[model samples]
Target: MANPDECDTMIVGLGAMGSAALHHLASRGVKVLGVDRFVTPHIHGSTHGRTRIIREAYYEHPCYVPIVQRAYELWAALEKEIGERLFVQTGGLMIGPPEGELFAGALRSATEHGLAHTILEPAEVQARFPGFRVPRGSLALHEPRAGLLLPERCVEAHLALARRAGATIRTGITVTGWTADDGVRIATDAGELRARTLILAAGPWLPALVPDLDLPLNVERQLFHWFEPASHPEWYDAAHSPISLIEYADARFFATFPDVGHGVKAGIHHEGAVIDIDAPRAPASAAEGVEMQALLARYLPQAAGRIVDRATCVYTNTPDHDFLLDRHPAHPNVIIASPCSGHGFKFASAIGEILADLATTGETSFDLGPFAISRFQAPAT
Candidate 1:
């Protein structure tokens, strides 16, 4: 039996990645404990958004294709395990000029992986979905197996299953600091505990927790808005419309989701203010809403309606915008997972399994070369 004060593995931050990790580790019969400062599925962090996009033909890199594919399978299995619908299959569209990064990257991944997709010109896009006004020079890459994940429910399900599997969970407690000797010792606001392994999955709070590493993690404030359709409401439904990432301007992109209860959701990607996580976030400005409405007026004109709701979230981005998943350089028993670069929620299910594999075996089959911490380290003189 595991001691109440200690466990085989301790996961910090019960958001998307941490909750999933706890579930996977517990399901494997490993004695694990998950601690979070706030009750999970809360709006305080990055995981509270109602809808998150999940796509297979990844534009980031071909290497992520397999990982996301596995995530899709695991997501389906999770739905089966919980007997609830978590994923909504609305398909997905990558729209931009043929030579632009958005469209080209999606096409490359599709071709390399032989994923089923279609290339639709602007005229075809408008004809198929009258709600859209695809730019004159833009094309869209449509893939069948892309959609949105119910983020809050996903986190809730993971934590529920983890508890059912005998994993210990503590919320409303903060980890102040940690030290490693014979094993890992975590100091929290309530008390201290020890674990053989520690996984730091705290999204934006990661850099502060591991000050020795001096990680180059940037926390950016992002906003997502839900607007009631101004016209052709049926055309914006999941059956007629797919979640889309559109490169409206050169090297600038925004994502749009079909109405799933609240309203048609959309957000500009990665253009938010870089903020200090500890500081109070500035409220979304009227100018920001006007900018978004203007974009919609040009592209998704039908979705340009009165704002039903809006929320702020943060993305802990790395310099390269890729993920950072690896063990601590000096402490092999310690693993660091800062996967949220605005595109990581979908992979949380699979990343949890990888974190479990690393915790138990110290290695994973997934090639984590691109995510290695050494990539950011200075070369030896």
Candidate 2:
């Protein structure tokens, strides 16, 4: 942040949204300065997981379907621009009881969107995939166009392209505070910078930056464990295996990825310790390891070899598990987005465009009403 007042757009947190916003804004010929406390792709936030799930038929809500649709386009365009593979099409399976959230959500979204999906019985799933064994009453909705997103690479590609497109990306600097007087003035440890607009995609740090907003963003420390496949590593490779989400019990779900560089990354998405982003992640516990062991032994028996590695990431979640993307109710020049509610990485590219659009034109073509701040607005005393 050389000159706080000199920037046309100062974007904080360059991991996913910030990087995307910088690239999009730079491409649109905006003088933008993208700042991050740590250099993005640096494994300090939620976006550092080696891979993130990217399912098209969003069971969380139908509103997310279109956002993901645009995200797919942006990711494809990004892959073309960077010449690096970001998404892998390994059909996705969401398994649960027919009336469970996983099943009902998938069914609702699939029916609403007319997506190509098939509901299969537990035995049918086992017979077809041969890689999975579900409980007797469980079923699966198969979405063919779903897979994983390489998180670090995606961020790197976005930032690299943004720099090439003339966006100044600064890292190793922390924004102490900011204000929107006329445009926006940001005070960082590095220096002061100014922008016509500001975007707060600061993930876990959102509440810290805008304490007045009283945002209900809880940063949970989530873990991903990888294991060497006991059998059929080839089929478990990126080519053959499908990314899986299994809901064995009520509100208990875990997502799994195929063998990437390390091994098979599997973890429970919503279950983890609530963390403050600045603090180090809580150490993995023996009890948690035992739980994962039981989970794998039952849900994913074939590849239950041994735990090879584990890593932690953050999940900034809203109360309803939806995203929060809206301009400041008080400061028009400031746009606040805390969308990565464990499901946001896939939408980063499009979110970058959405942020860029909101910053530049005050609106976007994508329907973001579901993420509006009014949903979290306070009640009168």
Q: How much does each candidate deviate from the true structure in C-alpha RMSD?
A: 1.0, 1.5
Model 1, residue pairs in steric clash: none
Estimate TM-scores for all models: 0.98, 0.97
Regions of candidate 2 where Cα sits further than 4 Å from its true position: 1-5
Residue pairs of candidate 2 with colliding backbone atoms: 3-193, 4-192, 4-193, 4-194, 5-194
Worst 10 residues of 1 by lDDT: 1-10
* Top lDDT hit: 1
lDDT of 1 by residue, 289-356 (tens): 88888887788898889988888999999999999999999999999999989999999999999999
Relative to the unseen true structure, what is the C-alpha lDDT of residue 346 in candidate 2, on a scale of 0 to 100? 89
Candidate achieving the largest TM-score: 1
lDDT accuracy of residue 187 in candidate 2: 82
